[model samples]
Structures are given as structure tokens and as C-alpha cells.
Target: MALLDIKGIDVSYGKSLTVKNCSIALDPAKICSVVGESGSGKTTVIRAVLGLLPGGGSVTAGDIVYENRSLLKLSKGEWRSLRGRDISMIFQDSGAMMNQTRLIGKSFVEYIRTHESISKQDAWKKGAEMLGRMRLPDPDRIMNSYPFQLSGGMRQRVGIAMGMTYQPRLLLADEPTSALDVTTQAQIVRQMMELRDEYGTSIIIVTHDIGVAAYMADHVVVMKDGRIEDQGERGYILNDSTNAYTRKLIKAVPSLGGKRYV
Candidate 1:
């Protein structure tokens, strides 16, 4: 059985529809990237999976099933119980979402304590270790610093560290590398791939960059104007596309280290 199944889901803001009957089934420990241009409903799909649709937006039809249970049917409390434990998300500009008044360690410890029955001291230790794993130069100093004290890249890595600390069964990433420089983007992508390798976490990424899809996805789903334009294994999307939109996406990706897109 598929680990996560999104079947025939329709999302909307007010009465105007966005995602129309979009269906995707992801296997455990694999990466499936949802690719598209802006406003193509790529990020909407990620929000639906996470059940945070910005108030007015909602899943008006269809169901999201994780481990064979429908997420739409879950109560708010039930969903909360499952969200950070079984599923986690890496948001675009996640660092900017952090509270400026609190030290990074305070926020980190609080999150860990909320999710696990650990002492604040232990949570602090765990948070520091995770930061080190992300290759931060000084995990202790980072923990002691405020969000404004760190660089954009550092802040982004800290966010990634926080997201991966629990090692959830599934990870949702929304344009995780879009604002990052190429080198930092590559590093973050590699760290995420390592999480899949070391912990067998299933991942769904919403991105406009086909280069990121090519680097990390096992399966690819292309969206255009709020619909699935094309989908298949990475090889098929890269080497045997039958859709014009998919072809355009492939052509847009810059050649990497003399490696062809195909």
C-alpha cells in the first residue's frame, strides 16, 4: 500500500477552485516532488497535506490518506496529535516565522518539549546536536543567539534542523531552496536526501525549480493552472516526457556540472 495517498482532492479559496481532483500516491522512504510555475497550485497541495490552508482555503472535496486513514476526517485535536509527530513541514523562509524576542534555544526547546516528554535540558541537548548535524559552525552559540543574529543561510539550516529533529514518517517541503544561494541550496537538499537515506522518511516537495526535482525526486508530478499536467518516475519525466509543459520545465533547468537534464 502507498504510504501517503492524495486522491481526487479539490481545494478552494472562497468559491473559486484551486487544486482539482489532484491524486498522488507516495511510497515509504521515497521522494515525490510537485513541480510547477507560481500560482499553479503547487504550494496549495502542500498546505492541504499539512492541513493549514490559511483560514479561507479548504479541501472542499476528496480525501488525504496517510497510513490508510483519511486526514480530512480527523478532528482538529486528532490532527494536532499527528502533525508534528508523524508528519513535519519545512517551510519557505521558515526562519522568518520564528519569534524574534525569544532566543533560538528557547523556541527549539519548547517545540521539542511539546512533541516529546523530555526535560528542557535534554531537549536543549538534542536541539544542539541536531544543529551540529546540519553543520553549523557553533551550535551552542547559535542556540544562544536570536534569529536576527544569524545569517539567512544559518537561519534556514536551523529551521531544517528543527524540522528533522523528530524524524517524522513524512516531510513536506515548500520551495525550501528558492530563496537560498546555489551552494546553500545544494547543502540543504543534500541534508534532506540524507534524512531519507538514514531515516527512511517519505518526502513531498512543492517547487518551481526542476533542478531540485531532478536532484531529489524519485517520482515527479507536474502541475499547471491547478492540475496535474504530467507525472511518472524521474526517468520518464526527464527522458520520455509526452507532455509539452513537462518538456518546457526540463528545458528551463540549467545544466549542472556538465550533467544533462535528461
Candidate 2:
């Protein structure tokens, strides 16, 4: 069975429609990339899945099924139970979303404590271990510092570490690498793939970078104006697309610098 099934959902904020009749199925341990420019509803789709929609935004029609249960029908308490434990979301500019006044260790430990029934010491240990796994230098020091003390890359890695702290069954990552340098972006992408291998986590990545989507996704969906314009397996979408919009997207990926010959 598919782990996540988004079936013909129409999301809206008050009277304004956002996503319309969108459907995608994701299986365990696979990567699905949703590509679109900002405002095309990529982030909004994942936010709906995570039950994190902003005020006034709601799923007006259709169903979102996660592990055979209808997510749109879930109660607030039910959502709380699934979030952070069974599913997690890594936001764009996650570092900026952090509590600036709190020490990293303090907030990290609090996050762990909130999710799991463990002593603060144990939670801190787990947080530290996760940081180390993300390849952060001097995790001990980083943990002791405030969010402002770390570089953008370091903070982003810390965000990743926290998102993966529980090794959730499904991960919703919205532009996780868009803020980093190319080298750091590559590293983060590799780590996300490794995370899927290590934990059998299904991933839904929302990005505008076609290059990243091509490199990381097993399946690709292209969105335009809040609707899915094209979707298929990675190879087919990349090479054999007949849709003009899909062709335009494929051509948008920047090529590596190399000599070209006619």
C-alpha cells in the first residue's frame, strides 16, 4: 500500500483557492519531488499534509490519506500524535525559525523531551548524537551556542539533525537546500538520501531547483498555478516529456560548466 495518498485535494485560504485536484502517491523508502516556482502551491501542499496550514487556509475538498487513514478528517489531538513522531517537516530557512534567545542544546533538548518520554540528559545525548551524525564540527560547542552563533550552513544542518531526530516514517522537506551554497546543498541532499536508506523514510521534497529534483527524486511532479501539470517516473519526466511546460522545466536546470561541441 502507498504510505501517503493525496487524492484530488483542493486547498484554499478563505475564498481564494490554492491547490486544486492534486493527487500523488508515495511509497515507503522512496523520494518524491514536487517542483514549482513560489506560489504554485508546493509548500502549501506539504503544509496541508503536515496539518500546519496558516489561519484561514483549509482543505476545502478531496481527501489526504496517510497510511490508509484520512488525514483531512483527523482531529487536532490525532494530528498532534502523528506530528513529530510518525511524520516531520523541515522548513525553508529552518535556522531563522529557531528561538534566537535559547541555547541550541536547550531548545533541542526541549524538542526531544516533548516528543519522547526521556530524561533531559538522555534527550541531550540523543540530540548531540544526531548533530554529530549531520557532520557538524564540535557538536558539543554548537549545542552550547545560540542559533545566531552558527553559520547559515551549520544552522541548516542543525535543522536537519532535529528533523531527523526521531527518524520519522515520512519526512516533508520544503526547499531544504535552497539557502545553502552548492557544495553544502549537495551534502544536504546526500544526507537526506542516506537518511531514507537508514530509516526507510518516505520523502516529499518541494523545490524549484530542477537539478536537485532530477538528482534526488524517484518520482517527479511539476506544478503550475496550483495544479499538477505533469508527473511521472524520474527518467520519463526528464527525457521523454511531451508537455511544453514540462519541457520548459527540464530545460531550466543549469548545466555544469563543460566544453560543448556541435
Candidate 3:
């Protein structure tokens, strides 16, 4: 069975409809990418799956089913229990999401304790180990540092480490590599693919970069004007799709030495 099924969902913010008739079914241990320009509702689709729609926004049609359970119906307590343990999200600017005043370890420990009853020392140790797994050198020093002290790539790795701490069955990443340089973006993408290989985690990545989507996704979903313009397996989306918008987006990818990266 599919791990997550988003069935024809429509989302609205107050009276303004932002996402319409969107559906995606993701299988276990696979990566799916939703790509589009800004405001195309890519983020909204994943946020709906995570049940973290901003206040005044709600799913108005269809349903989101994770592990055959309806996420739309989960109570607050249920959501709290499920969020970090079974599913986790990495934001676009992970450093910006952290508390500027707190050390990385402090925030990480608090996050761990929120979902588990471990002691502070144990949580700190675990957080450091996770950071090490992300390949950050000198995990101890990193733990002692604040988010501001780390480079953008390091901060992104820290976010990925935290999200992967529990080996969540599903990982939602929203433009995770957008803020970094070309080299760092490549590193982060490779690391995320490695996480999927190591943990058998299914991933839903929302991005605007078609090249990134082509490089990582097993399935590709193209969104335009709050709707899915085209979707298919990677091969089909990259080569067989005849949709005008999809073709336009693919053509926009930059080329180097006369070879298009995608």
C-alpha cells in the first residue's frame, strides 16, 4: 500500500482557495518532488499532509491518509505524538527556524524530550550522534554552538539530522537546498538521497528547481496556478511529458558546456 495518499485535496486560506484538486500517492522508500514557480501550491500540498496548515487555512475537499489513517481527522494529542516520531519536516531556511539565543544542543534536546522521556544528558548525546551521522565534523563543538555560528550548509545538515533522528517513515523537505551555494546544494541533495538509502524513508520534496527535482525524485509532480499541471515517473516527466508548462519549465533549466543538466 502507498505510505501516503493525498486524494484530490483542495485547500483554502480563510475564503481564498490556494490549492485545488491535488492528489499524490507515495510509496515506501521512494522520493517524490513537487516542482513549480513560487505560489504554485507545492508547499501547501506537503503542509496539508503534515497537518500543519497555517491558521485560517484548511483542507476543504478530499483527505490525506498516512499509513491508512486519516491525517485530517487527527486530534491535537494524536498529532503531537505522530509529528516528530513518524514524520518530520525540514524547512527552507532551517537556521532561521531555530531560536537565535539557544545553543543547538539545547533546542535539539528539548525537541527530543518533547517526544521521548529521555534524560537531558542522553538527549544531548543522541543529538550529537545524529549530527555526526550527518557528517558534521566535531559534533561536540557544533552542539555547543548557536545556529548563527554554523554555515548555511551546516545548519541545513543539522536540520536534516534532527528530522532523521527517529528515522521517520516520511520526510517532507520544503526547498531544502535553496539557500546554499552550488557545491553545498549538491552535498545536501546527496546527503538526503543517502538518508533514503540508509533508512528506507519515503520523501516528499517541494522545490522550484527542476534540475534538482530531476536529479532526486523517483516521481515528479509539476504544479502551476494552484493545480497539478503534470505528474509521472521521472523518465516520463523528463522525456515523455508533452504538457506545455512542463516543457517550458524543463527548457528553463540552465545548461553548461552545451549539455543541459537535467
Q: Evaluate residue 64 in candidate 3 and report its C-alpha lDDT on the 0 to 100 scale.
A: 91
Identify the candidate with maximal lDDT: 3
Candidate 3 lDDT for residue 159: 94
What lDDT is obtained when candidate 3 is compared to the true structure?
0.95
lDDT of candidate 1 over 102-132, digit per residue (tens): 9999999998998889999999999999899
lDDT of 2 by residue, 1-262 (tens): 9999999999999999999999999999999999988889999999999888999999999999998999988888888778988998888887788899999999999889887789999888999998998788888998899999888778888988898888899999999989889998988899899999888989999999999998999999999999999999999999998989999878766676743444
Q: Which ten residues in a row have the lowest lDDT in candidate 1?
A: 253-262
lDDT of each: 0.91, 0.91, 0.95
> Each model's TM-score, in the order given?
0.95, 0.96, 0.97
Which of the predicted structures, 1 or 3, would earn the higher lDDT when compared with the native? 3
| Each model's Cα RMSD | 2.5, 1.8, 1.9
* Residue 187 accuracy (lDDT) in model 1: 85
Q: How does candidate 3 fare on TM-score? A: 0.97
- Any runs in candidate 2 off by more than 4 Å, and if so which? 257-262
Ranking by TM-score: 3, 2, 1
